[model samples]
Target: MPRHQLRLDASSPTIIVPITARDVTELDQSAAASAAAPAGAAAEWRVDLFTPFTDGGGGDPAQAVAALERLAGLLPNTPILATFRTTAEGGSAEIAADSYAALIDALAASGLAAAVDVEYRHPQADRAIAAAHRHGVPVVASNHDFDATPPTEEIVARLEAMETAGADVAKIAVMPRSAADVVTLLDATERRYRQARIPLITMSMGALGAVTRIGGGAFGSAATFATVGAASAPGQLPADGVRAALDLLHRGR
Candidate 1:
């Protein structure tokens, strides 16, 4: 498998494209087009093997891994981040904690993906991190609050928790009820970014929070999620749109 470690820093924030695959062939075509594009973006395939957010219905662990392997064959040069978001976390499917850990372990071992996005609430979060490290793949500890944005301190606390668990990157997504909420989320991201050793993928969701999606890097966010074909979250701009926004924002900085 190819190596896929994200290069994020204080100066340069990257764009991430989320791919919600309906089928292997669809994923391959979308990924192939993205691979041929000039945009500097990473691909995140949502492997909802048992999740409710899957395009058609639930799938087994083997199906998820098989799909990933197929995609790897098509995009040898593209870095893929495997994610299995659960229903409770605004995803469509659910897998027991043990099963989740086992699936992540398998993905890490396969080397089909550069990183695995394991939920922060995963029962064996620490174990998952260790397993990914053993396989030389990164763990992205992620949390999402679709209802409201938490205080900056609470957000930082969560990011720190991921770092302590040995995650290479931390991701937090929150919903903003107002413009002020967006500021709170960004402030929290910037604060955590300054203190944490790991890179942060933080964003406030929805139209109210769209500005942060474009200019989040200015406040210490390491990457922004955009859509290549289908969007996984609210207010996610197209990859080119995101790239253009980032370029426009940075030129002024």
Candidate 2:
């Protein structure tokens, strides 16, 4: 059978669990465990197989490829996302744009992941996105603002840029210091939901803005990143907690 093509929709929230287990067997078990759980609030439970954002890349490309090959065999039907976030963008690792693009291209061709994430403003985002497209893998054009939320209009423009660059998903993560700032993030996501060309995955990081992580799905965001054992981003709730929250909200509670 052909591989399962990943698709996230606006019907309910797609809760993504970032897998951080260093042990390969542990990672496969996490994926299997989530898949075995009964579906309720979350539209889907997808896996984001990636390193925590602080090391840039602790290992070489060959090691990464080896890991991907393992994941493919372990979770053949599950949707996996391959992401390499840079330290400059609130992640811990950094790689040259050319090499990053090359790595993404290779991963897409490997068929281990259904989608690859590219920092939207990276110098070689276009190259990486194009390469993913050529391999029939979707690209999530992502941007991060760890310090503060940009103006709502500016956020809209950023999403538009991602759409123009051929992203299948336009994602933005921002930090909010106050209730007002979280409101701003939601407003931007709502506006883009109507106008943007593709689905959105936006969130406000940190405790002050944590509500936005769960609430964004109600407003317009299509996906939320949740943690299993470790969190890849701030304000990430555990996957089970996220599903529960989505259930409550979806019921108008």
Q: TM-scores, in order shown?
A: 0.91, 0.87
Q: lDDT of all the models against the reference?
A: 0.80, 0.74
The per-residue C-alpha lDDT of model 1 at residue 42 equals 80
Candidate 1, residues 172-241: lDDT per residue as tens digits?
A: 9999998889999999988888888888889999988988888888888888888767789999887787
Candidate 1 — worst ten consecutive residues by lDDT sum? 49-58
Candidate 1, residue 26: CA error in Å? 2.4
Estimate the TM-score for candidate 1. Answer: 0.91
Candidate 1, superposed: residue stretches over 4 Å from native: 36-38, 49-59
Regions of model 2 farther than 4 Å from truth = 22-59, 251-253
Q: Please, what's the RMSD in Å of model 1?
A: 2.4
> For model 2, what is the C-alpha lDDT against the true structure?
0.74
